[model samples]
Target: MEPDAPITIFGPDFPFAYDDWLTHPAGLGTVPDEALGTEVAIIGAGMAGMTAAYELMRMGLKPVVYEADRIGGRLRSEPFVEGEPEIAELGGMRFPISSRSFFHYVDTFGLRYSPFPNPLTEAAGSTVIDIGGQTLYARTLDDLPPIYREISEAWDSALERIAGFSGLQAAIAARDVTELKRRWNALVSQWDDRSFYDFLSTSTEFGSLTFRHRELFGQVGFGTGGWDSDFGNSMLEILRVVLTNCDTDQYLVVGGAEQVPHRLWTHAPQQITHWPAGTSLSSLHHGAPRAGVRSLRRLGPNRIEVTDRWGDTREFPAVIATCQAWLLSTEIDCDEALFSQDLWMALDRTRYMQSSKTFVMVDRPFWTDRDPVTGRDVLSMTLTDRLTRGTYLFDNGPDRPGVICLSYTWMSDSLKVLPHAVERRVELALAALRKIYPDLDIAEHIVGRPITVSWEDDPHFLGAFKGALPGHYRYNTRMYGHFHDQHTLPADEQGIFIAGDDVSFMPAWVEGAVQTGLNAVWGVMTHLGGRSHPDNPGPGDVYDALGPIDIGK
Candidate 1:
């Protein structure tokens, strides 16, 4: 089947088949008549949804945003000790410099950022690993055995190769298909359909390097144990990271990543009336075409029904969905078949790894060690002891007064075991810290425990971000095809469209979400033609084409 063709699937019972639910009196009654009319309806008020709404309002379309939870879906900030001056991120923390669009929005919105120092420079304590029951204090990757070195080399090489190409166009521009094919082959080979343990068993590097790589990968990637975690999991994600790093320099957002959407909301034009709460979209009735196409449905063409905690429903013409593709596939009663089959299959194949980040507050500026590369005290420590993955420190700078934040990234599959796991993790992290800063009392200086955000269990978020498992990348590429090049809908199929990070070229980062929302709005405007509003022109008029902007400017 062609990639862009609509997907159809059959099963004993289509779990997502919403026809029955939509037609049921309870379901139909859930939607109210008042919600039958509006210009646009936006679901999920994360960065993607907010950006889309901002763009729509700029184009003269008033959009109503429906959020199941807080406006910032996963991009949330929590106070560490409640009323304390310090704030820590419980969800979606870092933003790489490679995210050009995200940075542009930050700059355009006047959000500020301090330089994030290299995280591996500072001396933390050390860990005594029981290798064959003989405990030894190990510090750096060098402490790993020879076998682990080989695996690290392979992982690093794969990363470097993917980092070579700047963009899809640049990759395609290479005249030497042989070299390209060779490189692609090497990278694709890593996505062998096998479990991580199997791959490790085949590897000659079973010492520290192997241990370090597995722990780090599990912590950063899966968020728990590397035991059953498949190395081939999320092949597309690995590719996306390599491509993003290669494309441009990445940076973290200042004052937390949530500021990106908050800025967009602030900058939205005044003409657009963001509908009040309690709007719900019912059935969409259409009329004949006028000029091009006129949606006779009470709501313009983008019909959306929004219900709050109280269950009041309101409608809008157009709706933009910017949450996880899986959530939308299952939760929303739209064309279930259009998104469900692939989504369900992908979800079944994919598993979310648990991550726990502990932020440690130090008494003073401790620059005990310096990174050879970045020459900064901020340390990025990776453990090979199977206890935890790694820890990254963010120097609060001289202005913040003895404030240093350390993030311990741990991977676990079970949230039920998180508390005990976290206790073990803290113990291990402190033990590792003692190796480097033996003279300093880490326990005395340690003012608080780490804050954990279980992205895997977050009811609204189901997973940290979208990741592919083994063969799922190919399937995603195929699924993404359905929405990318499609034309605007006719009156018959008006008011139904999808947008989110899951629909973009990148996988599950801020860049992907922003790019997807931009494309969605652009596509809508292009189909509508004319001016979207008086001041803001439609997509064709605003920009030559819907593509990535050069964020370097």
Candidate 2:
């Protein structure tokens, strides 16, 4: 195990312990007898929505969940059209072990997982780093080019020197709320207004390197994939990713990541209240969620009305919107009075990263085989400066069909193929892959048609996830602490809550979604005149001492 820092209990972003709230024997909070049968409107049946619904149902409140699309939402795992028993993780493929809040559900539901096939992992078999027309195949980072080594070292040195990365990571791991706040808030104040690219260009360690080195750093980032698209984003966002180890020690669900939400919807836990012994979230919804929420309106003082796409309307004392905030203006008919002007500006300013993925099912894990002459694996997990940014290979079993993510790209690369058909997208990806392995015929091993996704084109989800821009921490704090700022909001808007990855300080992570969902649940419980257990307090319970990290202040 890594060396421990001074241990202190605090939440990941704030000082509130969301994990404790969920595991507490008393449950989140108990509503009054009158509020027992009342409904709480939950929009978007994704990870956040389902989490809130599951907890609300357990606490005796009926959550009327409305999903615009499928149950999994952005956690979609596309199965092969031919039914070859393989899946393509179009969204949210890998999960970091550090995400305790999300793993709570994974552990409770007994969902099996394995190490994701990232570069250099044993599951990856071998990695091929193709950059600047030079392709190198290796099993570990040591075998990479000297320039790549320099780039990696420079990044480490820059983080440690500029942001106190090592100490902050220790504090985060130890859950030392005091130390984390001290370190994180200081860094946020320093870097919240600085772009990630600015940090790279200004840091003495990175500045000493050549322009080629900086470009190489962007082309191939430390853990998951490249960081070029994130250059313009806030350095604070990148710091959060590194501090939380979001890119390391990752795992993928055994079957599909979507199963996490699907299982939560139907699993009947033992600590539930009001509901019968075998009750589940699906049972409360009658096995099918209501249609998509078309409009959200403030119906007088504390009553918020929700209208579904089918023209049916229902009133709830509290409403939690787990969908992307952009949909509030684009897809949903929302009353302008629901949010303050500054909050509206923040919602409009939320930037989403465009992501695209193309996957193919092959006859078997053919990549495991080695060539006779060169003695290298046939197809290796690839990271390249080519058109294909990242390529992953998934082996279900030695004999069963395998899945290959031909290309996983973001930003400009993703938008380039937004108009193309899935077949053409696959062809384009294959052509790029052929550049690295010209002699290999990837088409021959194909067992089914390819599956592709361009998240920007999906109306339900405008983009993959929020990529916080420079000076966006204030906006994030506003969104995340909306529950706490009820006194400042209009009377009609007090009962409405927003919780999702987009509203979290750590966007693009399931952990963020889960944490925010718990926040919303706490807010709704209090709005319905319920109080958190004394032993386990919600975020708002301790907001006075451990308020949000407002860099703007």
What C-alpha lDDT values do all the predictions have?
0.46, 0.86
| RMSD vs true structure, all candidates | 12.5, 1.9
The candidate maximizing TM-score is 2
The segments of candidate 2 whose C-alpha lies over 4 angstroms from its true place after superposition are 1-12, 81-84
- lDDT by residue (tens digit), candidate 1, 309-341: 444566644455666765644454444333345
Which 10-residue span in candidate 1 carries the lowest summed lDDT? 7-16
TM per prediction: 0.64, 0.97
For candidate 1, what is the lDDT?
0.46
Tens-digit lDDT track of model 2 for 111-181: 89999989977778899988989899988889887888898889999999998888887776666678878
Q: Give the top-scoring candidate (lDDT).
A: 2
Worst 10 residues of 2 by lDDT: 4-13
**What's the count of clashing pairs in each model shown?**
51, 0
User: What's the lDDT of the predicted structure labeled candidate 2?
Assistant: 0.86
Clashes of 2: 0
